[model samples]
Target: MNRQIERWRTWVWVLPAVVLLVVFVYYPIVDNIRLSFFSWSAFSTSPAFVGLDNYTTAATDPVFWHSLWNNVLYAVISLIFQVGLALVLAAVLEEVVHQRLRGILRTIYFIPATISITVAGILFSFVYNPQIGLLNRALGAVGLGSLAQDWLGNPQTAIFGVIGMSQWQSIGYTAVLFVVAIQRIPRELYEAAKVDGAGHVRTFLSVTIPLLREMTTLVVILTMSGAFLVFNEIMVMTAGGPSNSSQVLNTWLYHNAFLTDDMGYASAIGTVIFVITFSISAAQILITRRRRVQW
Candidate 1:
């Protein structure tokens, strides 16, 4: 009797969450897919079933291709600077830094992560401004004015500038995660490596990296997803640009759906993005699992 009552009590708590998921998550997903296949507008009385028309149109758009290509480039560059640097820093901090400094430095690195992306975007925007921006002024002060130009507002450099800012805001969190992963590595292994007369580089390559495979996989997954979903910085820094050079999928979708009121077309783009994100995530899992060694 008591077990039956406990199960019922547990279900009572779970039921509300289940209901909410069906209402918000599942229902919206189904509806969005449906919207993707049909032509509808904000003012429409009825949706016209158009099969893959929306998808075809979106696929053919020059702007769509540009946004996707830019997003890919951004993800690749960020993966290098963001994930690569974070992993190295994490390894160094874990192996060398004293405990007290480790704690303080973790806090310092993670501070930007706690700040709102909007605020950081705005701050970077001002710093990159041409006429009176700090970056240009500093360059000019150091007699590098010839190298300085409009950073955020310029077509040639705006996307890279926004990507640079996003990377700066992101690396802190990546480093903290890496630091935690490296710390959890057993001390016994390092001691064993020392007995073998392994140098720092060899130990790291053989001991630290092999152990940190999972964390590295995690960093790749998180950063890849975040890179694909980039919107806020583009909105704040370039609004997709002096042209559309900085536009990403999310921003382009927003432009079509909300700004242009092409709801069906945007939904189509959303579906494509969803598919691409899923494929990448699946590939990451497969690659990571294949490389994983059972310890």
Candidate 2:
């Protein structure tokens, strides 16, 4: 009787969360998957089951492919700038002897992350403006005027400009995560490294980098997922303009669903994104589990 009561208590505590997840998360996901197989515009009275036609349309769309490639590029850039640079910044900050200075610098770096993405996009758009932008003016002042072109207007540079702004916003957040991970490292290991005459670079490469493997994996997953879902900045700054050169998967999905009124195709894109992200997450879990067992 007591065990039954205890089990009932457990269910009572867990049931609300389960209900919420089913209603908000699982139901929507299942509905989206169902909708992907149907043909429906926003104006349609009812959805018509079209089988794999929506998926076929998405697969053959050249703009979808372009947007997908752009997302891949964003992921690569995020991995390099957000993860790599954050690691370096975290290492430097961790080694700083002055606590006050370190705290100030970290706060400064992280300030940009707290700003709204819409604001950042608008601010960067101004910075990238050709005629009166700070970037062009600075370059001209430094006798590097030739390097300054239409940053957001040009097809070649538009995506990269967006990427640079994203990195500026996110690198600090990534660095903070790395800093926390670095703080958890055992002090004895650092002392031992010092006793063994391992200099800063050698110690970082050997002790720090090796210990940070799990954190790096976490950051990669987060940064890559964010890259795949990037939309606001592109929407605000470029709207996937200049012939869709800066288009990403999320932006393209938005364009199709709302602007073009192709809800079925948008659902298909959403399904594809879910699959890709889910597979990556599952792979990461498996790899982490294996590594844990090996360790």
Candidate 3:
């Protein structure tokens, strides 16, 4: 009887969190999925049941496919720069740099990540501006004037410009995470590598990389999922402009929801985003679990 009462007391403590999740998170997701199956807009009083029409529309939409492709491109670039290169940078900072200098460099690298995404986006916009922008001016100063062009104005370069800004802002944050992971590694392992006559490059490949498997998995998952869900920077930078060339999934969803007032279609896009991110996360976790490091 006493144990039952104690269990009930524990349930009482857990109830608030459970209720909050159901009300705020789970309920909204369910409602959004429900909305995806109905034809509704901001002005609609009566939402008509549309079955799979919205999903079908998204499937057939060329812009939707393009947006998805942009997200894939974003994911690939983020994985390379944010996760892969960040790991190498983190290794260099943690293993090679003096302790005091490492701190300063880490702070310098992470400053961009501390800035607001909107601010960074706007700042990069100026940097990419054609006529008087820093990038073009630098190119001209270096006698590479022919290479200077409108970055965000041209569809060919707009997405890449946004991606470059994202990488610059994010790479340091990921590197810091790797730095922490690298710090957690036992120093004895490095000493062992040294005793075995392993050079820096060999030590990194044999010792650092293997131990970092878990952190690498986590960073990759985060970078990929975040790429698919990107919105603010793209919105502030290009607004998917110069002919819808830079439209990512979230921005496109926002465009349909608020701008076009097509709430149902927006919900459908939201569903797609959820499905994609969930799948990516799940697949990563599953694959990583199989190869997780053993003590």
- C-alpha lDDT values of all predictions: 0.88, 0.92, 0.95
Q: After superposing candidate 3 on the true structure, give the runs of residues whose Cα lies further than 4 Å from its correct spot.
A: 293-295
Listed in order, each prediction's TM-score against the native is 0.92, 0.97, 0.96
How well is each residue in 1-295 modelled by candidate 2, as lDDT tens digits? 9999999999999999999999999999999999999999988998999999998998899999999999999999999989998999999898754777899898998999999999999999999999999999999999999999999999999999999999999999999999999999999999999999998899899999989989988998898888888989899999998899999889989999999999999999999898888887788878987998998
Better candidate by TM-score, 1 or 2: 2
The most accurate candidate by lDDT is 3
lDDT per residue as tens, model 3, 1-295 = 9999999999999999999999999999889999999999998999999999999999999999999999999999999999989999999998899988999999999999999999999899999989779999999999999999999999999999999999999999999999999999999999999999998899999999988888998999899999999999898999998799999999999999999999999999999999999999999998887776334
Better of 2 and 3 by lDDT: 3
If both were scored by lDDT, which would come out higher, candidate 1 or candidate 3? 3
**Which residue pairs show backbone clashes in model 1?**
none
RMSD of each: 2.1, 1.2, 1.4
State each candidate's clash count. 0, 0, 0
Give the per-residue lDDT digits (tens) of candidate 1, residues 117-234.
Answer: 8999999888988887899999999999998998876778989999988888889899999888887999999999999999888898999988888888888988888888889889
